[model samples]
Target: MKDLIKAINGHLAAEFQASHTYLAMSIWLRKKDLAGFSSYMLAKSNEERGHASRMIAYLVDSDETVELPT
Candidate 1:
């Protein structure tokens, strides 16, 4: 269970990083006046955030220690 939690936390970190990267890309696109691309990237970033949330919720519900990644 501890190992599982650790793996899940690692995955969550990856998802968070992905979200951050997507957001940065979206902002850059918007600055370049590419509204469509920017919107798409923004949506992807939101989806990644949702994925991270679900992982955290699962950990909490499973009675596991939720150690947030740095």
Candidate 2:
């Protein structure tokens, strides 16, 4: 269970990193006047964030410690 929790936390961290990357891309696209692409990237970022949120909820429901990544 500890190992599983560790692995899940690692994946959660990756999800957050992906979200940040997408948000940066979205901002860059908007700056370049690509409204459609920017919106798409923004949606992707939101989706990644939602995934992370779900992971967090799962850990809490399982009564496991959630060690947030740095």
Candidate 3:
């Protein structure tokens, strides 16, 4: 269970990183006047954030500690 928790935390961190990346891409797209692509990337960023939130909730429900990435 400890290892599993650790793995989930790692995945959560990855999700957050992915979210950040997508958000950055969205900003770049918007600056380039690509509204459609920017919106898509923004949606993807929200999805990744949602995934991370779900993971955090799962850990909380399981009575496990969630360690945020540095």
lDDT of 3 by residue, 15-67 (tens): 99999999999999999999999999999999999999999999999999999
Supply every candidate's count of residue pairs whose N, Cα or C atoms clash at under 3 angstroms. Answer: 0, 0, 0
Q: Which stretches of candidate 2 lie over 4 Å from their true place?
A: none
Question: How much is the lDDT of residue 44 in candidate 2?
Answer: 100
- Order by TM-score, highest first: 3, 2, 1
> Runs in model 1 with CA error above 4 Å?
none
- The candidate that wins on lDDT is 3
The C-alpha TM-scores of every prediction are 0.93, 0.95, 0.96
lDDT of 1 by residue, 1-70 (tens): 7788899988998999999999999999999999999999999999999999999999999988777767
* lDDT score, candidate 3: 0.96
Q: Compute the lDDT for candidate 1.
A: 0.93
**Cα lDDT listed for each candidate:** 0.93, 0.95, 0.96
**lDDT: worst 10-residue window of model 2:** 61-70
Per-residue lDDT of candidate 2, residues 19-43 (tens digit): 9999999999999999999999999
